[model samples]
Target: MQGVPYLRLLGLVVALTVVTSVIMLIPDWNGEQASTAAPKIDQLLDVAIILSSFVFSVVMVMLGYSIHRWRARPGDESDGAPLHGNTRLEIAWTAIPTAIVLILAAYSWIVLDDMEATASNAMPVEVTGQQYAWSFEYPDENIQADELHVVKDRQVAVEMRALDVLHSFWVPEWRVKRDAVPGAPGSGIDDDFVVTPDRAGTFTLVCTELCGLGHATMRAPVVVHETQAEFDRWAAEQEPIPPEQPQPAAASSA
Candidate 1:
């Protein structure tokens, strides 16, 4: 029957989609889930991968079948039967894809809202980006250091600013990135974002934007302390060393 071939094609599409989706999800595409937002971000990415794989499988299968089924035989130059487009099929495809897009858009919006939600007790950390280095300041502790340090399980609100040109603050494990502009509008130049590190480890922070000649060397270390006490100790250690006082020449010429 005519329906048999269509059903077989549908089955093939479904099978290939599943196989490809699993393959896409299986590898360690993301390095590690260090931040609280990692799980939600990963889930959203997985959904995207599944949808994309399904669409790809459907398109490829249909194209392959059409080519194989309608190819001209050797020495056959006669014109094929004339056919018109199916209005119902066209409407179905258009409506289905539009619906899918709307649903995904809604879902993505919700996820972004949740990820960017602010915390009441988030610690404020000032971030400064220069041509070849980064500096982090803990305003509450009055500590300034080249390395970023924060306590685990606490949300850190990073207020970022760029000293020279445009730069982007990115920590791959945190699953969030924001731009640091020099002189934009009201507070837009000083962008801020909250990140909660769930695990205690060191992560790499890099500037994604092409700043200048030393762009490749523009990287810093982010250390997530295991406890508040540990972070406090580290902050205390960062206190500035007192300037050595002049000894008055120690009774010159005694």
Candidate 2:
């Protein structure tokens, strides 16, 4: 009899968690999984969602049950019985939350490790972000292009840098974003977004950070080539960008 309420609450929480998690997982929450890093990252996010759903269910069920069961009755003024907190339940909640946090941290580390894993035959592309545009430079080919071109099934090790103000390199399909820090020569600007694009298609490279008025238009094309030959053919036809351009729109995304 003492455990009847606890059992009922547990059942309600479980039911709510299941329903919430299924509803949350039904949609393509993160868009198409276009990069090699997408699956693992998405999996990690799903785990978090499910965990959050369970936590939310617990809180909601407990709050509702307490409100209904322990409500003050509409009667004459009377004193309520004095009670102390349940030490066991308190310890349980603290320990459970700490354990949950540790589990999430461990899983996050694994996904991050996979995202940062080094790969052979990685392509290097310099990602430059300014107030209003993005420019991609192929250091090896010495070709500067407005479009960020990479070979499919290959790792694109992007070296990110900002010119005018702080910017961020974000492609939603890539499932990972990194900040482009502005720096002068020898200023130790070290940041990169390592992405292995599996799909061969064009995606938009957007600046997630708010830089300036033109920030909304600060977008470029991310073209993934199906083969090395195709990428080379396209690269061969592009002209190197001039040393400087006053109008950023002319050089890159307008």
Candidate 3:
């Protein structure tokens, strides 16, 4: 009967929806998402994508079947059946997409606002970029060095500046990546978020933007100190080089 195909289609759609949702229910937190409020945002976006995929798949399937099953047989092409429009169906489809888009846009703006608000109180750390090297400057201690040092449970706001050319500051583990532009207003500047280091170890800071021939070597290390004392000791070690070993005074006298 005609109803049988409709029933079957509904059953298939329901089955597919349930299966996909169940699969996405599993949470994977590498580290960055574990600390920030990004997990909720991620879940919302995932739902949107899943809904889109479901709709796209269903439409494609229906279109393919119509093209094949409803094709004219032999020479019986008598201008198919009369075409008709469904006003209610058109309104429903259009309104649903518009509502989803509006909701997503509002949610995204709220999240961005939260991030910028929290940035004001973050601890400042200056990040300097150059050919095959990256140095971190702690204005609080008047120290500058090639390696980055940070204490646990502290919020760090990095101000990145490029020495030679354009580059990008990227740290995958922290879910932070910003371009280190050259000469542009607000150029050579960016920030990142690292609330806590549950796992103490080194992470790579790569130059995302292509600078030059040594671009591959333009990488740095981000070290998360175990304690504030350790960080202080490291900071002291990087103090400006003392006046080159006081050269022996020439034997003047005579």
Clashes of each: 0, 0, 0
Candidate 2, residues 1-254, lDDT tens digits: the string is 15448878999999999999999999998998789999998899999999999999999999998798778888847877787878988999999899999999999998898789878889888888887989888877878888899999999988987877899888899898988887622466558758899999999999999998888999999898999999999999988756764554423342
Ranking by TM-score: 2, 1, 3
Model 3 per-residue lDDT tens digits across residues 1-254: 13337666656666666666557555553335422444545655676667765665466556765686788889795986676876876897798778867877887787656544554445578776767678777878777777777766566777766666888887666555676654432532343433433345677788888899999998888887777798888888887634442322542233
Question: Per-residue error at 224 for model 1, in Å?
Answer: 0.3
The prediction achieving the highest TM-score against the true structure is 2
- Per-model CA lDDT versus the true structure: 0.85, 0.87, 0.65
Please tell me which model should have the higher TM-score, number 1 or number 3: 1
Clashing pairs for model 3 are none
What TM-score does prediction 3 earn? 0.71
Each candidate's root-mean-square deviation in Å?
Answer: 8.4, 4.4, 8.4
Q: TM-score of every model?
A: 0.87, 0.90, 0.71
The superposed Cα distance between candidate 2 and the true structure at residue 208, in angstroms, equals 0.1
Model number with the top lDDT? 2
Model 2, clash count? Answer: 0
